[model samples]
Target chain A: MHWQLEIVFFIVLITTAFIALDVKNLLVAVVTLSVFSFISALLYIVMGAVDVGFTEAVVGGGVSGILFIVLIFKTSRRSSD
Target chain B: MTRKDNNPIVSLLSRIVSPFIMLFALYVIFHGHYSPGGGFQGGTMLAAAVLLIRLAAGREISQLQFKKSWGTPVGSVGVFIYFFTGFLALLMGGNYLDYSFLPLGLEAPVTRGWGILSIEIGVGLAVMGILVAIYDDLLEGEPND
Candidate 1:
């Protein structure tokens, strides 16, 4: 119910998304993506779904990070596009 | 002798900090039920520690250092652990996730707490694995560090 926390979370979420988008380096973008995930998880906590939010942070931010890194290793690091 | 004996903080603290990080991670995992923190949070924290090692020790630290394969497995494994606990409860003939259903002990709240704890551990492993996986993948993708 605390409005300030909600505002802060929103700002963080937006910033994360922007960072993920703006960063040229794929790795930097990926790290930004994690930041986004963490912010959303915080939102979930505010919404009273602490457990669900926790899961999201873990999976979206954590495991997904690992997957991205692996895929990067398998593929080319340079953005040919 | 020179390289190994670099800055005082980074040198002496290096050995101490990593273990402490690891221990704190475990502590967070076990204390999830009674605390505000839980599996995912703890897991990410754990991964951060590894990332720190990677940053400080450079890539050559460990050959078996959770490169990639660990990611997907950890994710699914966490879910598996969660469901498995529920299944065990179901087999015992109590409603899904019903603590009394488990044969371990009939203590109401404790049984439930235990279930959540197991799930948290799984979640911690999964989340931590994923964070590193993502970082490695993303960084690896970049042209250069």
Candidate 2:
């Protein structure tokens, strides 16, 4: 059961990373990065690194997400093609 | 890009929720020794709560909660606090950050615990201040007027 969960999380994490990189819209990419952070946090928790997991969840998902959105507001949203 | 609006529901909800988040962050900071949380985690949480308000209500209004100018100074104070603790230990003829020589006349372990707590508090303050300062600086270059 544990290994299955880990495998699923790993797969999702990789998927999110690729999506974050591949997405042309900066806003969507930022959101996908937030998803990646969340998955990484979950993986940390499952591995028993609770403190690390908490930091990843809060800093990665919460704070960075806000910062990125704020940046998008300040700059252009669409990537230069 | 969508023009940012001060939505009523967002402002109202954020006002109510931010205080709770701050309270929880404090809990995490102090309870770190017995729990998984510590200064960095709690401090980031504090920043998150404050940023939520800034994002929802606009910077001018959020200034009432925490002024824009206070971020860097507050962070410096935190670092000073951490350093001061070590300096205190040094004044007592111990090595820097040597908890056993803290001025309090307590058992060695207890003194260490107190020292650790103080350090954690300092770290929390520093982290909180720095994060907020970074956010403020990031937005500063843009002409808001």
Candidate 3:
């Protein structure tokens, strides 16, 4: 694996994680969280764990995103704090 | 989402794509032993496909595709399948989940392969059903604003 690509992914992963946390809009946060998950899955594949990457991509990015969106719809979309 | 908010394009496209996602999920499940994907990943993919339709087509329409009431029963059946496989092996003079002792009338290696496949199928079904069930329950429990 190329170190350059790994570095790029790591940067994006960290960026998304922070954005997901810092965002005030719950929907945006959830979308960013999904991005974070997909980036991490890419990192896992780059690190040679294909199976782990696949699971992360499917569960973290897809299922969890839907669940979070449903949650946002159920409650308030804007954060109180 | 409400019917008033439905977009025809999104509905059509999701309906078209969901089937292919399901097809790929099945492929991943069956080829799991030879590939990077297995039961859980495949099952999640399957649920994603179903959820896609649910999201695009609204709740009432999607019910015809997969009823919310079916989710728990499907999950229960999947668990039963997994348990029965293991128990059958135990009853046939082998350790629990020992495939060679299964009454498949095949060679040990082949029987083991079949056993693993069956296990994978069980796991896939269980994961798919439970995930969808969770989604359904969450939506059903949502408070009206």
RMSD each, Å: 6.3, 2.0, 2.0
Model 1 alpha-carbon drift over 4 Å, by segment = A1-81, B1-14, B64-68, B141-145
lDDT of 3 by residue, B28-128 (tens): 99999889998889989999999999888988888989998988887788788889999999999999999899899999999998888888888888999
- Clashing residue pairs found in predicted model 3: none
DockQ of every candidate structure: 0.14, 0.75, 0.84
Candidate 3: share of reference interface contacts reproduced:
0.92
User: Top TM-score: which candidate number?
Assistant: 3
What TM-score is obtained by chain A of candidate 1? 0.89
lDDT (tens digit, per residue) of candidate 1 on B51-114: 6565454454433455555666777887788788888988988878776567876587777778
Score candidate 1 by DockQ. Answer: 0.14
Residue range with the least summed lDDT across 10 consecutive positions in model 1 chain A: A70-79
Ranking by TM-score: 3, 2, 1
Question: Tens-digit lDDT track for model 1 on A1-81?
Answer: 789999989998998898889887888888888889988998998999887787787667765775565555556655577
Alpha-carbon local distance difference test for all models: 0.73, 0.90, 0.89
Q: Model 1 chain B, poorest ten-residue lDDT window?
A: B1-10
lDDT of 3 by residue, A1-81 (tens): 579999999999999989988987888999999999999999999999999999999999999999988887777545588
lDDT of 1 at B144: 28
In candidate 2, which residue pairs clash? Answer: none
What's model 2's overall lDDT? 0.90
lDDT string, candidate 2, B43-122, tens digits: 99999998988888877788999999999988999899899999999999999999999999999999999998998899
